[model samples]
Target: MTELHRIAIDTMSGDNGLSAAIPAALLFLKEYNDTALILVGDESKILDELRKHNQEPNERIKVQHASEVVLMNESPALALRGKKDSSMRVAINLVKDESADAAVSAGNTGALMATGRFVLRTLKGIDRPAICAPIPAASGHTYVLDLGANIDSTSEHLYQFAIMGSELATAIDGVEKPRVGLLNIGSEDMKGNEQVKAAHKQLQDGGFNYIGFVEGNDIFHGEVDVIVCDGFVGNVALKTSEGLAKMLSQEIKAGYTKSIFTKIAALVSYPVLKSFRQRFDHRRYNGASFLGLKGIVIKSHGGADDVAFANAIGIARKAVIEKVPDKIEEQLQKHLVD
Candidate 1:
């Protein structure tokens, strides 16, 4: 029998709120036989939503009530102290107490990270928890870390990010020796600032496969499995990539519909275009893992739809099943002892 994995979801959070999360939970339950869900939110509203779908809390599904809701623009400190009963916090509390294997939230990123760190705390030897998410690449995808969790990271922090990211790739992608790269301005050894240079030196002697310095363009090359950088740089790179993808998509659509001849050409190339779109769909990569925490917490995009939110739940399930946090702690211990 498959061991059951329970995930706590912040149903009252995100842009679409229950409309997206409830449907996503239903979809996820239908797909994953061995996993259960605990929808965290106002009980009455949750029950109403389930009733709308002709469903109720069953053996595989449960409800946990949270009276408060965190606003999107709310400050992290305010959300942490002022809203202890918020859906986001309650869901994370379930994970902290081991009542659920993981927590999934499409809430404010800052509040989610802050609450996660304060509640679950960081694993030993990790100074800060970093946001790690998958980015579309040429082959499969590359996991990039410190996406928006820390604006300024020291050399040791970058080294820790590499270790956590490498282990994440190993667990999720089944890559034995995932190639790790330090994101730099250029590929040359003399290119980056002192922090990156120091990180490169530390990673060189680190146990895993260190691929030296990688430039920004190398992210989509699919050669490096993990790219390490400070949160500020990583967040900028992520947003830029998202913007570029959007622009390219719009441009392609515009070019394809300009004339009758192009319209016919679009018809001919429909299959290929669809395949490309599916390959790089941002919705498919919606979940971001908060690494270095003692437990698993996945942050979905605030405006994620049902499909995107379901994908985030799937990520949480994967992390739970793979024991990602435990593996990360073990890796850190090994590195520290060495």
Candidate 2:
């Protein structure tokens, strides 16, 4: 039998309450044979929600009580200073203390990022840690880093992100020599803002398969593997992509429901449409890994539903099994593509 990983998950802070995370946890546990979950939250609330699903947070899943709750409006430092007993704090401590292999949370993102760096700390040689989210592309998915973690990211910071993201693509996603690209305004090699232009020049000279600059439109085209950019630019790109996806989806829904004939046609194309919708779904990339941290810290969408929260826990388990952080350190030392 394979070894089961102990994953700590925060249940109190997502847009959805224990209602969503608990059920999703139950669903994932059913599929994963070699994994145990430690849920950190109001124990009674978690247990009560579990009972709602005719289950309990028992041995396969354990509960740790957290009294303080971190609100979304709280500042990163303020939340960290006072809410020591918050679910996010308890979850991070599990990995920091060797109690769990990784930690997953759907809480105040700012607090999670702050507490993760403070408690678990960054890996050696990594000036700043980054968040890697799988962006929708043609064939499968490509990863983008620093998606709002460090808004004022420097050029050296982006280079570090490239190293981190490439290793992840190869190790976890099985993408070898992941074609890297510098996110920019134009496809031409010598275009865009100074930071992007400089980063492009540096990557072009680097050891990886640096594939020049990729425009904003190429994100969904499946053209690149790892996207390199400062947090300010990367965050804008991510939000724009997400917003466009949502708007398109809503428009499609309206068109389909506009009339009885359209609804009938929609039923005929429902399966194909469903697949298309799932194709660009952000929920599929619900958890964003805080790469370069000593232990795994996955940040889920604060507004994530139950399905999203459960998927976040699943990501943490995968990181533990794949030995992501250790692999990141190993790959950072050497620039091998494979």
Candidate 3:
């Protein structure tokens, strides 16, 4: 029998709360036979939602009661210091105590990061943990790091993000010597500020497959395996890309429904349009891994629905199976010792 991997879900933390998480858990359980879930939230509410779908606690599904729910706008400090029994904190506690292999939450990004760092702590040789997630690319997808965990990062932190991003691509995507790049204003060596330039120098000699510098456009080129930047820039780029994708999708639909002629044209192009939609659906890439943590934690979008939340759970499952934290630690130790 395959070893069972358990994931703790903060069922009370997302925008849709139990509605999204409960259904997502059921969907995920149906797909992964060797996995179990520890749903962390109000026991009564969770059971009620499960029963709505005609589900009851079983050997594979367990419930852990958490009295509080972390609000989406809750301050990180408050959530960290005050909401000790919040679903988000409880879910992360499961990881720290080794009760669960990983934790998945669609809560406040700041709170999740703050609580995760406090609870599991960063791995040895890592000063901070970075949020890493996949962005759709031309060839397939590219993983970017520091997606809002540490808004202000130093050159050393950027270098650390590169190492962690590279290892993640290797472990999760099965890439060998993943090409890593420093996000800069220009592809030239002297285009960015002090931080980017300093990071570029460090990466050149850092021994990984450093690809010099990559601009914002490079994120969609699929040529670079990993792009590393501070949390501020990465977050802006991610949000901009999301906005652009949404605008383009809306424009496409509006254009297709403008007139009877266009409506007929849309029918003719339905297959191609569907393929495009499926290829670029943001829901397919819902999970962002908290890299450099002692344990695995995935952050889903707060507004994620069942499909998207289920994708987050799948990400946690993959991270557990690949031993992502161990791989990152091993690489960090090798680099630090060298």
Q: How should the candidates be ordered by lDDT, best one leading?
A: 1, 3, 2
Arranged by TM-score, best first: 3, 1, 2
Q: lDDT per residue, candidate 3, 169-193, as tens digits?
A: 9878899999998999998776898
Tens-place lDDT per residue, model 1, 24-69, is 9999999999999999999999999999999999978899999999
lDDT of 1: 0.94
C-alpha RMSD by candidate, in order: 1.1, 2.1, 0.9
Return the TM-score for each candidate structure: 0.98, 0.94, 0.98
The candidate with the higher TM-score, 2 or 3, is 3
| TM-score head-to-head 1 vs 2, winner | 1
- As a whole number from 0 to 100, the lDDT of residue 49 in candidate 3 is 99
Error of 3 at 322 (Å): 1.0
Clash counts per candidate, in order, are 0, 1, 0
Clash-forming residue pairs, model 2: 20-306
